[model samples]
Target chain A: MGLGKTDKQILAVILAAALALLAFQYFSGHRSQELVLEISRPGAERLRMPVSSLPQGEQGRWHVEGAAGGVYLSYWPDQGVHVDRATCPDQACVKMGFINKAGQSIVCVPNEIIIRLIALEDPAGQGEEELDGVLK
Target chain B: MTAIKGFRGVTKTYMKKAAFVFLCVALSGGLISCGGAERAKVPSFSSTRFLMDTVVTIRLQVIPGNQAGRLGAVAGGGQPAAVPAQEELEQLVLAAFNRMEEIAAKTNRHDPGQGSDLQRLAAQAGDGSWLEVSRDTLFIQEEVERLEQEAAAVLPAAAGLVDTSLGKLIDLWMGVRETKVLPRQEEIEAALALSGMEYIERDWAGGKMRLTLAGMGLDYGAVAKGYAVEEAGRILAQAGPAVYGIIDAGGNIKTIGQKPDGSPWQIGLTDPLKTKELLASIELAPGQVAATSGDYQRYEDIEGRRYHHILSPGEGWPVWYSHSVTAISSGGLKADYYSTLLFLLPAQDALELAESIPDLEAIWVTASGELFATSGIEDYIKWQDKSGYKLRD
Candidate 1:
């Protein structure tokens, strides 16, 4: 059986449309979205802001009043977030360096503060599932 | 013949149109599914608080749709039950945290003024009087006693590895952390002499317990966090199967149930050498818990030697056999106890013991960065980073 020229054109158009739709979905689903830093303290409102909102440079730091004392957090757009200083005795949070990946957190036990990174979109597309918990 | 040819041409045109419609339907269906997948994420509620001297995070996935019938079954009444709203979920997490706080208060031994069960027991030591305490305290003491006896029957040397009566020894070392000065040999010996489960007496029926030795004290530091985590897990479990959650008190993790998709939860293991990097990841079955004991968490350097918090009951000093040990068990207490126990033991003994125990798996990272895991754990563990560690065959 032979098909007319118009029929071949119709088939070609349909195939192209399907391929375009697939390509759009693929790129849109995997595109990286803005990351947010979530700082939570007991008996206080959670502070969430995009990574880009942080000021860049040595002076770009935020102080969070915690249960024990306060913690100073500095951010770098490229290097992620880290605790510059903390009043807690252990200073474990300060020792936990920059954490930019989703599900990673810096916890100050005495201060009762948790700083975590969260992605605005699906983390599964990054080829890793968000960890439920970490055993240290 | 012309009429037949014309009819065939019409049929061919109709077939092409049908193919075009089918392709459009398929394309739209694919897009719709992609949209659905984006919106199919289970609603999650998470809360983090400081409890048991550690950061505890509880995250739960609320089952989709109205669960009135299931709630009625759980409530044991025919009346239609209220949907588990966001506020109810928050309350549920709060309840779990409150229960952990109760356990923490009952087991605290630091402050005598707190009048905690352990503190009261310590103050009444050697008085020849039984002091009443909370049920939580009694249960913890009983479990410690049972574990000690069980370990003695098999491995006598490992019996005192997790002694809760090491309060004096712990206090002595804790002082070292402050002063950065090593305790004299005689001082360590005296503290060790006062540390043993045998010095403690329990009147289980009357809910009373006592320390037979003067100056003897009870420190639930080894087991309290895990016990509190277990208690929190229990509360979450009672919320019914409609909710799957995780209770992470510090690094002691107790998962309530599987994820909404029925896949096992993935728990990351932190490298002791590199505090920030992940050593590996393991898939945990529902209702399972994993705990790790390592020197990296709390340690002090004195005279160029590092002394950690996990003191040996015999030497009354830190054990340096392994860098860290992670244990997986069905209950949080067992996981916590085993992680410490395995850390204290030599690597070979730890692996052997872990294999012998049912429903228990362990991974040991030695000071040299060598990894040894139980046979059962090999199937579940996926090594994430092995740059500095060697996995033994």
Candidate 2:
């Protein structure tokens, strides 16, 4: 009734598989917030807006006039909001469009405008419409 | 003598097992920790079309472990093996483009019900039916002409007679019906057909709202790259145990499996203005896709104005908002397309659209280097300091 070759081999295979699965789960569990962008300017005003207050499903927006431009910032669930519009001939901020998701961005080079996408805390119990802009 | 031989053999066997067990237990901890270090494998392939003229390079990694047990070795349909996964990916993209062309034809083609003959005569004067009309695009055009004629006849007289509201509504309806810009895509059409919803109606499935007619045309160009990555991931996963792979189709990427030391896959985000530099670095785990689109990636300077390649379907021009946008999600295709679409839409509008899809997550970067992200985006993002981009959310 001693352990046989076949039994030992089976045990080895099973052990290997279990170890692999455990590793997979461990890796899956450890998550890091992807830093989509960083905004650093000398004297630019920063505005904080909720993801809900912004466009429901969109990420970011820019309003640029002749010499000024403002950018609205938000996240998927939070719809992080900001204003970076100023009057400038470049009006480059308006042309850049929205940057809602991580690793995406909208920059107004002329007005020194910068808006980025980043991770945020979820506001629970938010309506779908309010959260739509952040989500999209 | 026989008993002694048996005893010696047993002792040797037990010693071997003990050593193996010891080795297994010792390695278990490392193996467990190493599981998360999934590095993207760059499959060797050639470039096809460039994203904004920047050459799109593709790399595919095949999974070597359990994935093989699940998705490899079995051919679903009759396809050739000489075709690299990258080529397959390329084909998928081309197919989508072709589909778009088809939808465009359907939208602009003349419809006979629109009084084609008379409409053409009015527009062409005495040219008769000899106008340079594409046979494939005739029906829809005809329909548009008929609608236009009818609208013209009614609008002149009703310009001031009826309530402005009724007249405006009619004009809007006629305009849409006459000049159809939104083309029907296979995925959207398929989703609608499955849900039995009208173009204007919306329903929720897979935690995302299915809009019948999103008004925005569908192009898999953004999402298809991710889809190709996903397909490559499927192939790698089926390879065998200890198999690790990464699929990077253009900028869209998917990685599933740990590296030798068990670290997450690191991806560099490109700076819009400086193509040679990395704006930021992102780490991704297995079963995830990442995509980035930047205005600097493809742009044509016209009269000193820089125009990027990411164009809005209805606007017929590049979007004006953020310089770049990137989205990471479980599905490669979803992440790829969402990033591109996100760049064109308003911030709030993009978020709403993303929110409609349950599995989709996103992060946005503005022109001034400000950052924002969806709530779920935190689950997958890994940021690096010294990178000018900052997260908003």
Candidate 3:
């Protein structure tokens, strides 16, 4: 038997509701992921916090005790993260300047510490492919 | 009229049944799509640490049900096994880092207090005594010798390009990096004289090494990090075939397996001139390594002349034939060794040498901002920035 006007309307309403649910799932899944800063030191627990949680400007300065000595770190919304002071001889971490992008890191070999920037979610499924690593 | 009414009633019941089934199907499809998104959230673990005087990062994704057979074979001891848990992967990463740290300590030439084997051997230089060293040290020295012989066979001028015995020359350059002063001719000559493979005596059977000259020394700065990275990759590969990961030790990049999607890992080659930008991107398959030697990494400007840390044993000064040389080979040690060797040679000779070698490809950014790459790597390289550099045919 052919479907009547009322039957057709009922089917359309069901289909529309399903599509709306699917759309909601898709859009919510595609929301922009947060950027996180990961601070890791040898023989110590790693600390991970969202970049937005960090205080901006001079008030954002802080220090962490590393294997060698104390390493000072500062964060600015515009500049990202920077190693203001480090007791390591090379000062390589300090010289690394501000690292803001995902996968960028500052390493202090003498202090056995590493500070890296990472995204909370994988960006691989996005249109642009994220690099696994950079060879300098 | 009664018959028509009966048919309508049946039709209406059938329509309601059809509608319920369609609704169930649509809702289930939505649920399945959500399930897929949840499944895509694979367990990923990464660890970054300071080792070998550089930052080493190991990132791994534990994919389940991909290579279950291989994982069971390696980790399950003949039992039907599932994929490794998150904690096990973390342990594997830690193990890799521990191996790297051991290699770093053993090959360190700077401080004797670290109990470095290289330093101990250097202290006993010219004593005419065979000093037993760790197997790692012996392996590195022997590899250097083999690389030297292979390079010499291909191009006589390329011989001694990667001299691990250039400890004195490197020391002088380190001082120059700090003081930013060009060393006198006499001082350079003295360092060059003390630097040569002939001064390095080896007892392969006994796993012993020594330097014949009193002031001579052995340094593994070129090979140590690569060796460590190679070993780390080996450890990861042993864990399971399903474990896909990348170990990047300050540009000495080694991949354990392909990405979760079975695609190759992409590595960005940094621009030497720009320093902050990428010159190109290269795809690296499993078991392949990419290493780069650039004047931008460690250098000093003296009177407008830039002297990098990569010193030439023959010239006793930094080579300027290329701004940066990136070498890709099957093994990390080979890649590391070749990048430095090619950087020390003229651009043409470097390209020729790289072409002659099997399974080795090189890209050279010349001192004049011209780019050249081996034929095999042309397809793999995706140029990112061409504003300042011109690619030569």
Candidate 4:
């Protein structure tokens, strides 16, 4: 039993559409999403906002503020994240510059704010795990 | 006709088996994709708990892709063994910290009459008589005795500068944590007079140690934690050869192995003046132990003056030399002892003294805020903050 001419055309269309979907994903989607800035403050869950969602280099943005008052975090796609503004006395976290590496993190003990860079394979922000550590 | 149908049946069975195999391969691919590219490989794991009177953190690195499904000896193969490598490391690290706690219980001074060996020894030291010790206690006492000889040779203006003999001075200074009062100058002087390694006698053959001075006590403030950290590393190594772990008791950090990727571990050096800022990051190779002692942690602020815990042996007062000192040794005991010495030694003598010692790498940061490293550590340190003090090559 052989396929009819119409059946062959339908199968050809499905194969072409599947290949097109793969190409579209290859070029315009997925890979670029891996760079993310994760903000965590004491007594709250970690908020992993996309680097794109963060207003780039914009100081004093409410979007970056946290639970215990406000701790402003900033990040650029290539540069990484840092505490732009904080209420703490020393401002050591502000002085830490940026930690753009995959496992690097900027911690502010006074305000209990920690911003980490999670550079992973999935741009869609799935399967992200926090590095194991005790903050003293 | 019967033979032809039998052949057809065999052909159909083969086709079904082939389809099932293809489906299984597709499912495996899906599982790999679902796990994420990075997760499919062994990821670094960390855990933090309060141990040894401070926050103790442990980090274990990369379980290579090949070792992903395998569990370490501690976990065993009695259950669903698909536990990720990171999970395996976390469990093993917990075991290591438990070992540290057990050792701490045997030796810690703060827990006096808690049945710790230190408390028992302190009671025995009342009459300056020899007392037998457990194997763990003996190991720590031996290290303490060895450090006393090392410090006496190189450290300046010192007697209780780096030994358990300072137990008296430490007690006077630490006072009752609740009352939080500084001891009178005369009281400190009295404690200092009784402090010196010459007062202690050790008989390794008899497995006993004694304090010759009736009022003097022995403490391993600088040495015991390193021994504990190293012991923990030993336990992890026995469980898994590839386990790369670090036991960081405050500033004392010892690595069990190099990272799986074969790169050195990056350890941040805290700025002596700035309580929270990191002044630099140092890299350590496999089996290296690093420690940083600073004036920041334990200090008394009186009348707008800061008196750090590191006291000079000769002056009977806190030593005013460097704000902090960093030391890395091939082993934990040496690093802990030398780090304390670098902090107490005069700034002018520290750099040269650190260089004279073999198998020891040290960096001293003066109170005036200049960072100086011996030639051994010059290459390993990467300075982060350069405003107050420049990293002099």
Candidate 5:
């Protein structure tokens, strides 16, 4: 009634592989991913940067200059905001970024610049691809 | 062979039954006792009523017996004996009342600034040049003389009005007359200095001019409960690191330390109409103050028309809005004053003021059953019934 040796070996290997996968998922993988955005639009050109790459203390700000004008964008100490200053015809984008919602953008129509905030969890970015089999 | 097999099967069944019974007993006991953690002595907080005044009491969990001695030893002070406790508590309350009085005196406009009546008169009589004095100067001079006489008269009368120091504060508010001129001037100067009102001297008389308080009609009722709480805590804290302590002056309450089992204390805001009913319960940890002011506490029934005690500064009348306002802060005195002030101000303005302060929280229950509270309040405290009060951001 005992199982054959090869069959037992195969089952043991499968169990070991499952445990390894679980360990990998638990220890190193990120439980969450946060996106902090700073965007400044000057005339037609839009300047955007992720907070992760900037120096630790300077992550909440961005400076941009163009032929049309110069502007600065800074994050609010509370929640999210991107304040900008410019001499553009519309000056619309400067008033935007009070939020950084997924797929939302600060648009300066006259300047042809768009500062977008795309959530890292956005399904569209995956485009039907699997991300580490945890989420697709 | 058949008998042997039958005997083995019977034994197996009996063993299984015995195991099941043992398992059931173990599981039932575990469910009841919840495992070796001594049934958390539902550490209690009690309320005592004295002369229409209620004191909420919280008996905290600590290494019991002679805790005062241990605390005394740790703090390098002699153990405060049992007989002296009441006297000491009363003295602390009186001291705090004195400090409030000092603050009030500086804020009072009618007290001639440190000058004798004769000196003030001499300054006014200057070379008999009445025409040289400006109108504003003349008015101020007259105000000083009037205040001097009133101060002499009312100071003695104020001594007999209320039973407790708290009552004294209330009587001052009800009877005293004159804007908080001295305190206001000092506050303005402090505000300009950017040092904030807290850092300014507890007593700062503005312009050194003693303006008499109007008919001695100033009250510190709203602020006194907090003052009492702070005083009580000072005495208690001197004893040792108390896990939890609360002093509820009537409905106004202040809490410190964690609960007996080391959780936060849960405080219920009473429904103004149904005093027994709870509008909301808030969980607070150690070292915080919470004070409530309501229309129902001191309402007047004039021709069957009911009116509450909270009054507006400008019109000297009460403006109805929230049935009650409860403010939480680290300091009891500030929380006490602000709770009454918030009731007098608009909801939006009150919220703005609350936000300006760090570590401050509030719950406003309006006439419409709407509840307005700040964001930090939500995270720090848990609400029992989300139904009665609507949460305004």
Candidate 6:
């Protein structure tokens, strides 16, 4: 039963592959290999898109309709997400500039919209299914 | 004999099982301990907005220990639902800023298109007419009157320290900052004469504040912004005790609660003379505020000597007793009023005055490069420049 050399080789290869995947995840800073964009209107979720799937991160405006009104948002990979335009009287949201960091968001109260960048690598905010209530 | 050999072989397999279980236990135990550190990791959320004629930066955090095992519930119905705790904290801060906007709209004095209630009060004061304003304006006026009476009762020698009666003096000095032209001495003297509260009347029952002196103006510079900060704190306090953060409104700051790890909030004091330098710092527990008044910011050079904004009613000239004074109190408005009042007093008198008031402490930077503080201030203040003398008593 202990004589098979092929079994030993197979086990070693599997262990090496698992360790390599973990190392890549740690160094690259994203377990999922891509970033997810979570969009919500004030309190509720509106849409979620992968950063690469939406559009090329050119300096351009994107609009997403909400319950209150249309929320004008823009994304630049270099700068992050900001409110380009909105229906609100005070342009405070527009003035907030871009929020690119994980768990950071641009909240437009007038339009009741929140745009947050979720990094799978950021365990404090890891889960995409729900706004994490449990921190650990 | 064969059975005995089989048992030995089985014992060797059991030993392997025991070793593997011990290694698994060690690795998972390490993971749990590391994850415990992350639980203490309460992320800080900061937002900056230009409001009230200055940049207002608000930093807020949620105490993880307050979650009480309930983490994902939305704040309430009138607001959005299904919000995370971190976003909920940010939303609460934004709501506070919105309240500040209402305050700014009511108090703005420079807007000519649609005058704020404060501007209207001034216009009515000029024409000898009954001035009606909002409750917020009335509240500010009441606080000014109370402080005015307090100063007169305690420090008669420093009478007219701030000159609540000289609304005209405030306006004249404001012109100096904006236009960089010093007002003629005779004009300032005339305003200083009428700047006595003996000339004005307040009808608390009727919600009216009237000025009897003709050609006089009204300014709420000493206490307006701090009062707004206190009001904003009240808005957040209604949310819950879990709102732990700092609201730095220019130099005046109000801290809501302890930090994430339950440590007191530590604030760095900005150097009055040196730009981008910290002269000292102090720790503040929850529900405390610190307000620093420095004569360095608004000043004009006349010949060689510099003239600052805080002017004396008795001499109708800039007060040069101290470079800066920071006051600590429960409410921001109180701290702000005391800082301005202390800045006008001589350094020695300022320390004595701070000691007399209950729950009030002050740290003063004297004109002669000395740092002095009330007996209570020494316990909390972390002095950066020990070169300056400290009046520990």
Report residue B202 deviation for candidate 5 (angstroms): 9.1
Better of 2 and 6 by DockQ: 6
Q: Per candidate, chain B TM-score?
A: 0.85, 0.47, 0.87, 0.79, 0.55, 0.81
Q: Write the per-residue lDDT of candidate 4 for residues B1-393, one digit (tens) a residue.
A: 995455345544464454444444444423334234432334455444444555455556555544433433324553322333645665677788788888888877776458676666666764857787667777776776666566557654433457667788877777623355667789878988777777766777787767777667667777777777788777766545445566666668777754545456655565667644456556777778887778876777776667777777666677778888888887777888888877888876877777777888887788888888888767866565457886554
Off by over 4 Å in 2: A1-136, B1-220, B379-390
* Model 4's TM-score against the true structure: 0.63
Give the per-residue lDDT of model 5 (tens digit) for B1-393.
995455345544464454444444444422333234533222222111121122123222232235534543454556532322333433433443344333333223334574432234234332322223222233333333333343225243211121111212332333322332122334323323321112111112232222122112223344544555565566554424433344544455556444334346555555565543345556565777777778876655555444555654333344587788888877766566557666766666666766766667887878777776877786644333435556665
Sequence-dependent TM-score of model 3:
0.73
- Model 5, C-alpha of A29: deviation from truth (Å): 40
- I-RMSD for candidate 2: 16.5
- Candidate 2 structure quality by residue, lDDT tens digits, B1-393: 995456345654674675466555645644443246643442222112222212222222333334333333333233322223534533533443344334333322133545332233233332222333333223322222333343235333211111101111222222433444332344324332222112211111221112232221112233334544555555554433333434434366666554424456655555555443344455566667777777765355655555555654333345667777788877655576567667766665666556655677776677667766677765544443435667665
Q: What's the DockQ of model 6?
A: 0.04
Candidate 2 at B156: error in angstroms?
33
Give a tens-digit lDDT track for model 6, residues B58-117: 656555654512322323423322323765666777788887878778777776766887
TM-scores, all candidates, are 0.73, 0.38, 0.73, 0.63, 0.43, 0.64
Tens-digit per-residue lDDT, B1-393, candidate 1 = 995466356656686776666566556634544234433333455555655657566766565544534544465566544445555666777898889889988998774478998888888899899998988998988887776676567667677789899999999988887898889999999998887888888888999888999888999888888888888888887666666777766569888854656567876676677655567768899899898899887789777777999988888889999989988888888888888888999888778777877778998889877987999988778665457888887
Please write out the lDDT profile of model 3 over residues B38-138, one tens digit for every residue. Answer: 33334456655666656566767665565555555665677654566767777888898889999989998875488688888888889889888889998
Angstrom error of the Cα, residue B185, model 4: value is 2.2
CA lDDT of each prediction against the hidden true structure: 0.74, 0.43, 0.76, 0.63, 0.44, 0.63
Q: What is the DockQ of candidate 2?
A: 0.02
Measure candidate 4: CA RMSD: 14.0
Candidate 4 is graded, for docking, as incorrect
What's the TM-score of candidate 4 when only chain A is evaluated? 0.56
- Model 1 fnat? 0.29
Candidate 1, A12-87: lDDT as tens digits: 7877877777667666655444355666666332444445434343444545557887687777655789988999
Where's the lowest-lDDT run of ten residues in candidate 3 chain A?
A121-130
**DockQ, every prediction:** 0.18, 0.02, 0.18, 0.04, 0.01, 0.04
Measured against the true chain A, the candidates' chain A TM-scores are: 0.63, 0.37, 0.64, 0.56, 0.45, 0.57
DockQ of 1: 0.18
CA lDDT of B121 in candidate 3?
80
